[model samples]
Structures are given as structure tokens and as C-alpha cells.
Target: MLGANASKNSTLTLVFLAALKGVVGFYSGSSVLIADAVHTSLDIFASFAVWVGLKLSLKDSAEKFPYGYYKADNLVSLFVSIIILFSGVELVREALLNITNPVGMKLQGIALGTAVFSVITMYGLSKYKARVGRLIDSQALIADAIHSYTDVFSSLIVVITIVGSMLGIKWLDSVGVLVISLMIFKLGTGIARDSVLTLMDAWLDKDSITRIRQNVGSIQGVKTVGEIRLRKSGLVVFGEIEIEIEGDTNLKRVDMLSEEIEKIVKNEVKNLEHLVVNAKPGKMSVMKIAVPVLMQEGLHSKVSGHFGRAPYFIFIELEDGKIKSWDISENPASDLEKKRGMKTTEFLKNRGVNVLIVGEIGEGPFHMLRDSFVKMLQMPEVVEDVEKVVEKVSELSTLTAPTE
Candidate 1:
């Protein structure tokens, strides 16, 4: 709505300026001012096109157009570019004729005043439209803004031409028209290129994709980050991501993980209108199991009764149902005064611990670990030897059910 309003107002302003310049240019025989009037006249149509595009782009999606009418703005911008290029060609012809056959000029004071007024008006209007366009991310309005800015330059040239003609430099008017024509051609091609790219559905830049991947990877239960695709439509961005998870993960857990991923991506990325997350189950070839222990005793450590207060954690790396490697590390958050369970849960997560075996667990840590997708199993009794625990866990058939 803001963009539409800006376009409408600018169109009305252009109508008045075009009329004023056209009348004064003919009376004073200022060819440069007349050419500038033609350019301003074209801007009226360009601004009107922007207004229509912004209005149509806001329509809701229907059966015929599942993606909505967002591309209308790009189409309108392309149309405006064509108008600019056409006007540039016309100006080139007029400049050549004026140069080949110089005409006597009657420089009226009204012509110079009108040209000065146009410069000020167009400069202000250009700034206003550019601000509104950026605020709404409207390409059509931005294109119109560029058009208005070029008018300012053209009008400035008119002022110079009128003053020089009054001082006996009549040929300056022809050269001024030539220069404005070249500038208009350049601006038209640039806008046309951008409009074409957007219409083609170009991918988002690498930095945005990388940031999204990093955010998704930080979430728990995500084993691997797969392909990520994103594209822009008008002012909004749409994305799709593929993620890998444990093969045995339940449907409810998968849904929860998907929701988490969508939430994080939307929060971290700007202007994201929609996201589709694909969570695929992955085969478990290896397992990283963490056991809370009372002390660092290699495979001889005793299981700690309290998860948060455990002095150390023993990590066992198992492959193909066999213990491949084991390591014991002191728990850094064991002696924390507050949030010890939460901190310890984060610590294990950063170490890529997928399974946690404990004799007991506090409610806070239990839920935290569960949300992290860390499989928790309660020991039947206090075990004195970590070696026996490892042997029992290695047997796929004798493993106990996960803790509730």
C-alpha cells in the first residue's frame, strides 16, 4: 500500500511538471527543455505502471496461480524499462536533427524558471520514492525512483542549455539532449537486467545459505545437514531443507525436530515467508554413549546416582555392536551453583553424545536430554564396574527399554 501510494503521488506530480515544461519549452524554443518534457511524460506512464503492479502483487494466491501474482511487479518494472529505452531512442533522433539544423532561440525567463523548478521537484520526488521502495522491498517502485532521478539530471541540463543559449551558445541545447539520451539508455538496461534476473527465480546468495545451515546444525538430533534450497519471490523468501535423523526415532520425535528446525530458521533468517523441512531417517552404523560416573577409572568407574552431581563422564564409542574406543572426562558443570543440569546437558550435546546411561536423573536434565534426542536408559541397580555396563550395552538383543 505504501509503495502504491508513492507511485500514485509521483505520477500526479509528473503530469503537472510535464505539462508545465512542454508549454514553456515551445514558447521559448528551448529544444533541451522540450526533450526533458518528453522524458517526464514517459515517467507518468512508468509511475502508473508501478502503481498497478504493486496493487496486483498483493492479491491472494488462487487455483490458477499457486505462487500468487508477485511477479506482476517485475513485469511492470520490465515494461517501464522498455518505455525508458524507447524515449532514449526518440531523444537521440531529436538531438541529431537539432544539431544538423540549428534554430534561432528566444530565451524567455519563464523557461529557465520552469527548468529550475523541475530539478528541485524531481530530486525531492526521487528521494521519496526510493525510500518508500526500499521500505517495502518493491522493485517496481525502485525502478520508477531511478527514472525520477534521471529526470532531475535531464532538467539540470535544460537549465544549462537555456542559460548558454541566452549567452549566444545555441549549439549547447543539442549536445545536452545527446548526453541525457545516453544516460537514459544506461539506466534502462540496468533496470531491465535486474528485472529479468528476478523473474528467472535466482537463488539466494551463499552467505545466507551458509548461515541457515549453521543454525540448523546447532539443533540437537540432527545427524547430518543435507541439501538446502531457497528462492525469492517479490518481497518474500521461500526455502526447503533436508535433514537426517536416527532410523529408530519415533514419528512424534521427528515432528518435534521438524518444528524446531522451522522455528530456528525463521528466527535467524529475515523475510522468510515459508519453509518446508524434510526429515529422513538415517542408518545407525556407530553410536556415541555417555555414562555419568563417580570417578575417572577407565572401564572400572562406578555409575553416579545423581546425573547433575556426577564427577566425571565416560564416553564409549561402539561400532557394529562392539566397543571400539572409550574415554573418560571430568564434568565441568558438576560443581556449578545454578543450572548445573542444563549446562551438563549442553556439554554432552556439544561432544555429540547420542545415548546417556545413568542410575538416576533429575527432572530438569531428563527433559533437556530428551529434547536433545539423547536416548536415556536407567540402570536396574548401582553398578560398580563400567566394563560390565559396556558389555551389556554392546549386546543389541539384551538392551533395556529407554527411560521414560
Candidate 2:
């Protein structure tokens, strides 16, 4: 609403300036001033078009246009570009004709004053529009602001042309018009390129996608971040992402995880209007198992009865029902008297341990590991050797079976 109102007010101001310049240009016979008036008149139409585009873009999604009317802003920008291009071509033709048949103009004081006023007014208006456009992230309004800035330059040229005519340099007026026409062409081409790219549904920049991926991967349940697809509609962005999760994850947890990912991405990327999270099962070709042991011995260490108080943890990597590798490390949290089990659970999780073989576990750690999607297997008896534990895990069920 603020953006639309700003554009509306600016259009009104342009209308006044255009009328003032037109009246004085004809009275003083200043061709450059008349060309500037034409440009300002087109600015009025462009500002109004921007205002309308902002209003239409704010419309909610409907049955007919499920993606909403956000593209209206881009369409308006493209239309404004075409108008500017047309005006530039016309001004160029007029400038060429004037250059061939140079006419001296009677430089009136009112014409010079009007050109000066336009220069100051357009400079201020361009700054105002640019501030508002950035605040609202409106492309149409920003393009309109650029249009206003061009007017400032063109009006300056008009001022120069009027002063040159006062100094008896009549040909400078035609050259000034030619310069403004070229500037209009440059502005139109830039706006047209940007608007057309947006209309073509160009993807978001790489930095934004990378930031989103890093944020999503930080979520606990996400195993891998997949393709991130994002597109912009005016100031808003829409996208979907694919994330790989545990195969045994429940539907309720999946929903929660999806919501978490969406929240993170929204916070990471500005103007993200909508995001869809697609969760899929990750490949389970290998299993990582953690076993609490009495000592930091290889496969010869005896499995400890108490999980949290154990001095060492044996990490085993099993691939395709065969033991691939194993490592043993001292449990740093075993010396802690309070919340040791919970800390141990966190330690194992950070190591990417998906399965825990235990003789006994405290209630806190049991629930925490379970919630973290770690498969807990009960050790029937105190196992003396770590190798026997691997055989036992393989015999009970397939390594890929979901935790009960």
C-alpha cells in the first residue's frame, strides 16, 4: 500500500511538471524543453503503471491463478520499458530533424525557470521513489525510480539547452535532445532485460541456495539435502526442496521435520513466500553401531552392563551384513555424575551412530536415543567379545529392519 501510494503521488507531481514544461517550451520555442516535457509525460504513465502493478501483484492466489498475480509487476515493468523505448525512438527522430534544420528559439525567463524547477523536483522525486521501492522490495517501483532518475538527467540537459540558447548556441538544443534520447534507450533496455528474465522464471542466485542448504542440513533429522529449486515473482520467492530422512521415520515426525525445514529456509531467505519440503527415505546400505565397552580394546573388549558409566565406546561400521571396520574411543561423559546418559546419547548422535547395542540403559538416554531415531538392541547376556556382538546383531534381524 505504501509503495502504491508513493507511486501515485509521484505520478501526480510528474503530471504537473510535464504540463508546466510543455506550456513554457511552446511559448519560448525550446525544442529540448518540449522533448523533456514528452519524457515527463511518459513518466506519469509509467508511475501509474507501476502503482497499478503493485496493487495487482498484492492480490491473493485464486482458483484461476493459483500462483497469484505477482507477475503483474513484471508485466508492468516490461510495458513501461516498451513505452520508454518508443518515446526514445520518437525523440531521436525529432532531434535528427531539428539538427538538419536548426531553428533559433527566443529564450524566455519562464522557460529557463521551469527547466530548473524540473531538474530539482525530479532529483528529489527519484530519491524518494528509490527509498520507498527498496523498503518494499518492489521491482516495478524501483524501475519507476530509475525512470525518475533518468528524468533528472534529461531535465538537466533541458536546463543546459535553454542556457545555451541564451548564449546564442542554438544547435546545442538538438544535441541535448539526442543525448536524452540515448539515455532513455539505455534505461529502457536495462529494465526490459531484468523484467524479461523474471518473467522467464530464472532461478535464485547460488549464494541463496547455498545458505538454504546449510540451514536445512543443520536440522537433526535431515540426512542429506537434495535439490533446492526457487523462483521469484516480483518481490516474493517460491520454491521446493528435497531432503533425505531416515526410512523408519513416522509420518508425524516427517510433518514436524518438514515444518522445521520450511521455517529455517524462510528465515534464511528473504521474501520467501512459499516453500514445499519433500522428505524421502535415505539409502541404508551401511549401518553404524555403537557399543559401550569396559575398555578401549579392539574386538576383544567385553560389553559393559551399564551404558552411561562405561569407560569406552566401540563404533562399528557394518556394510551389506558384513563387518567393514571398527574403532574404540574413551567415553568423555562417563565421569559425569549427572545427566551422563543424556550426554552420552548426544555424543553418539554427533558421531552419526544409528544403532546402539546395550545391556542396560537409563530411562532418560533410552527415550532420547529413540527420539533421535537410533535403533536400540538389547544385549541378552553380558557379551565377552565385541565380535560376538556383531554376529548377534546380524542374526536377530536384517540390518535394515525398522526399530520396534
Candidate 3:
């Protein structure tokens, strides 16, 4: 985008230069010099077209153009080239006719001086434009740079013609015009070809594709870069890529993969815009393991036991071999005593303790604990025997909860 703006500025500057040249050329009465001035003047229009193209290209995607209006930039560039080509051809034809029949038009010293001035000014602008174009990957700026380069060539030829005419070879003036015209025509063709390719939605270079494939495939859990499709609309490189990975992967893992691929493409490639990542499962079967959670209540410990406290926290191991704490609590404790019980579970959960073993909990507390899917080990005192209670609670039947 910065490149586009800079290109617009450069074109505007060229337009001012052309206007100044045209005004001076008209009063100077040098037909050959005036034609060059007119060509430079058209550059102003070309620059305006480029500005419009750049503005449209930067538009966000919409229903009218789902990929945005980037193609407009190409159209503007193509139009500019055509204008330049015609201008050059016309100037050359006129110069040829003038040389065939001597005309009574006096070459003005100011015309030669203007041509020299234009060369110096446009040469700097062309270099600056090309530098910015390369930095921003802007095709319009590049095209403008090409146009400005032609301006330099034309100016130099005009200056040489004026010098030659003063040295008694009047025909050299006509020859200079023809040379500058040919140079303009050649540049116009190159710009036209480049613009046409861009408008045609040409794919990015092979090197870019290779880099994309390598970068995406290098991501963790990405088995291979299945396919990559790219399109350049104006300055943006819109792309869609497929990645193969292990089958039945969870949403979180897939999301991570997508993010990784996007980051790599954006950072590595200039002017990357929209990206679509299609994740495909590999042709291998893999086991789905349940992440384990430890439960406990005060001094009691259970690998998979239920807690009677509400708003309890759960601790689980992450894939990176690090422990993470998750608050499974939905409802805060209704009473002070219940709050204390909740805090106890939190402390234990934070410390990597798993299950809480309790029975006959309050309705709110019980619902909270059960909602987390913790293993509920229920036991009742049998004939006032604490040993029987412990035995019943320790039994594995109907105590363990199913893994998610």
C-alpha cells in the first residue's frame, strides 16, 4: 500500500513537470520539442489513471468483486502503455515528415534547456519510483518508472538534436526525434506485456511457490504441503493452500496449524493478503488419548474421584509436558462454608491434585462438582461401621466417570 501511495505521488510530480514543459514548449515554436512536451503531458493523464487504479485496487472485498478491485491497477497500467505507444508513433511520423520537407520553424534555445532540465528531473524521479516499487511490490510504480525512463531518453534526444542543429546538421534534429520515439515505443510494449499478464491473473513465480511449500510443510504437525494456489490482484497475493496432517485432529490443533501457515506466508512473502488453509488428514490411523486429571479432597487422593464442592478447579497436562489449571466452576458458593470448600478444591487442583472424594454434598455444590464430570465416589455409613463406609467408597464400580 505504501508503494502505491508513493507511486501516485511520483506520477503527480511527473504530471506537473509535463505541464510546465508543455507551456514552455508551446511559446518556444519548436515542433519537435513541443511533441516531446505533449508526450510528457499525457504522462499526467497516465499517472492519474494509475492513481485511480491504485485506489480501486486497495478496496476491500465485496459482493461486486469478491477479490477486490486489484485488476483495475493492471487496466490503468495497460492504458498508460497504449497512450505512450501511440504518442511515440505519432511523434516519429511527424518528425519523419518534417525532415523530408524543410519547415521554417526556428529551434528555440529555451526548448533545448527545457529538455536538459526534464532529463535530470525525470531521471531522479524514475530511480526513486523504481526503488519504492521494488520495496512495496507495486506493479503500477514499476510501470511508472518505465515511463519516466522513456521521458529521460526523449529529453536527452531533444537536447542532442538542438545541439546538432546549431552545428549545421539540421537533419540530426529529425533523427533525434525518431530515436526517442523508438525508445518510447519499446518501453510501452514492455509495460503493456507486464500489465496484460497481471490482468490475466498469472500465477506467482516458481520460486515463490517453492518457498510457500517449504515453509508450510515445516510447521509442526503438518505432514506435507498438499497443494498451493496463488493469484496476484494488484499488490496483494491471495492464496489457498492444502496441508496434510494426522487424521481426526481436534479443532484446536487445526486452528494452530492454520495460524502457523498464515504467519510464515505473510512474513516471508511481500504483499500477502488473504490466505485459506485446507487441512486434510494423513492416511495413517492414530490413537486418541484422553488427558488425565488428578482429584483429591484435603488429605484424601484419588486419580478419578468426584468433588462435593461447587466451583472447583481442574488441573490437566498439556501436550507440551506442562501442567495447566482450568476453573471448572460455573456457580460461586452460596454460603461462607461452601466458599471455603470451593477454595480447598482450588488449592489442591492448582497443586496438580486430581479428584475430590465426598458424599451427601449440598444440591448446589454437588451439581457443580458433577458438571465437571469428575468421578463421583458415593458411600453411605453401613450399620455405623466406618470401615464399611470406606470399603464401599473405595470400590471401583459406578465410581469412575467416562473419559471425554
Off by over 4 Å in 3: 1-8, 102-107, 173-183, 285-404
Q: Quantify all predictions' global Cα lDDT against the true fold.
A: 0.81, 0.82, 0.63
Give each model a TM-score.
Answer: 0.79, 0.83, 0.66
User: Tens digits of per-residue lDDT for model 1 on 208-251?
Assistant: 77887898888767878899987667656678999887534667
Estimate the overall C-alpha local distance difference test score of candidate 1: 0.81
Which residue window of length 10 is worst by lDDT in model 2?
395-404
Q: What C-alpha root-mean-square deviation, in Å, does candidate 2 show against the real structure?
A: 4.1
lDDT by residue (49-129, candidate 3, tens digit) is: 777888888888899898788888778788878987987887687678768864333545776777788889989988888
Residues 185-220 of candidate 2 have per-residue lDDT tens digits of: 999999899899889987737887898899889888
Report residue 299 deviation for candidate 3 (angstroms): 40
Overall local distance difference test of candidate 3: 0.63
TM-score (C-alpha) between model 2 and the true structure: 0.83
Inter-residue clash pairs, candidate 3? 294-354, 294-355, 295-354, 295-355, 296-355, 306-375
For all candidates, the clash counts are 0, 0, 6
